[model samples]
Target: MDYRKIREAIIEETSRTHVHLVEVLGDTITTRLLKDFPEVSQVKLRISKPAAFSDCDAVGIEFLVHR
Candidate 1:
C-alpha cells in the first residue's frame, strides 16, 4: 500500500470536512479510507476533542469499519 497516499487522503478528508460531531467525523474518515484504499480490510478510527470538559482531558469517539 502507498502510505503517503493514505496519509494524504486522511489529510484531505479532514481538511475539507465541516462536520461538528466527532462520530460524524469518524464515519467520514472511515468511509473515505475504505473508498480510497480498496486493499484495506478494516479501519479503526479515533477522534478527540481536547478539554471538552473542565475536569477531564478530552472527549472523543472511536469506531471500526470493515470492508
Candidate 2:
C-alpha cells in the first residue's frame, strides 16, 4: 500500500458517497454512514444535481459535519 495508492483507494471509496438534496434524507443517510463507518469521523458532504441543469450539469452544497 504505497501512499499515493492508499490515498487513491480512499478517494475512490469516498467518491461514491452522496446525499440527495430533495428528499431531506441526506442528514439521515449521513448519520447512518457515520455510524457504520467509524473511519468517517467527520466528512464534507457534497450534494449535487448534475441532471437538474444543462449549463453546469450540476449544483451543490457542502456541509462539514462531525460525529
Candidate 3:
C-alpha cells in the first residue's frame, strides 16, 4: 500500500468536510478510506476535541470499521 497516497486522501477528505458533528466527520473519513483503498480491511478512527471542558483533558469519539 502507498502510505503517502492514503495520508493524502485522508487529508483531502478532512479539508473538504464541513460537518457540525464529530460522528459525521468520522463516517465521512471512514467512507473515503474504504472507497479509496480497497486493501484496507478495517479502520480505527478517533475524533477528539481538546479543552472541551475544564474538568477533562479532551472529549472524543472512536469508531472501528470493517470492509
Query: Best candidate, lDDT-wise?
Result: 3
lDDT of 1 by residue, 1-67 (tens): 9999989988988889587788877888899999989999999988899999999999988898899
| Per-residue lDDT of model 3, residues 1-67, tens digit only | 9999988987887798577888888999899999999999999999998998999999999989999
- What is residue 44's positional error in candidate 2, in angstroms? 1.4
Query: Listing every candidate in turn, what is its Cα RMSD in Å to the true structure after a full C-alpha superposition?
Result: 1.0, 6.0, 1.1
| Stretches of candidate 1 exceeding 4 Å from the true structure | none
Error of 1 at 59 (Å): 0.9
Give lDDT for model 3: 0.91
* Cα lDDT for residue 46, candidate 1: 84
TM-score of each prediction: 0.91, 0.49, 0.89
Q: How much lDDT does each candidate structure score?
A: 0.89, 0.58, 0.91
lDDT of 2 by residue, 1-67 (tens): 2446444544554455653443344465456556656666775667666768777877766666787
Worst 10 residues of 3 by lDDT: 13-22
Best of the two (2, 3) by TM-score: 3
Better of 1 and 2 by TM-score: 1
Report the alpha-carbon TM-score of model 3 versus the true structure.
0.89
- Tell me, by TM-score, which candidate is best: 1
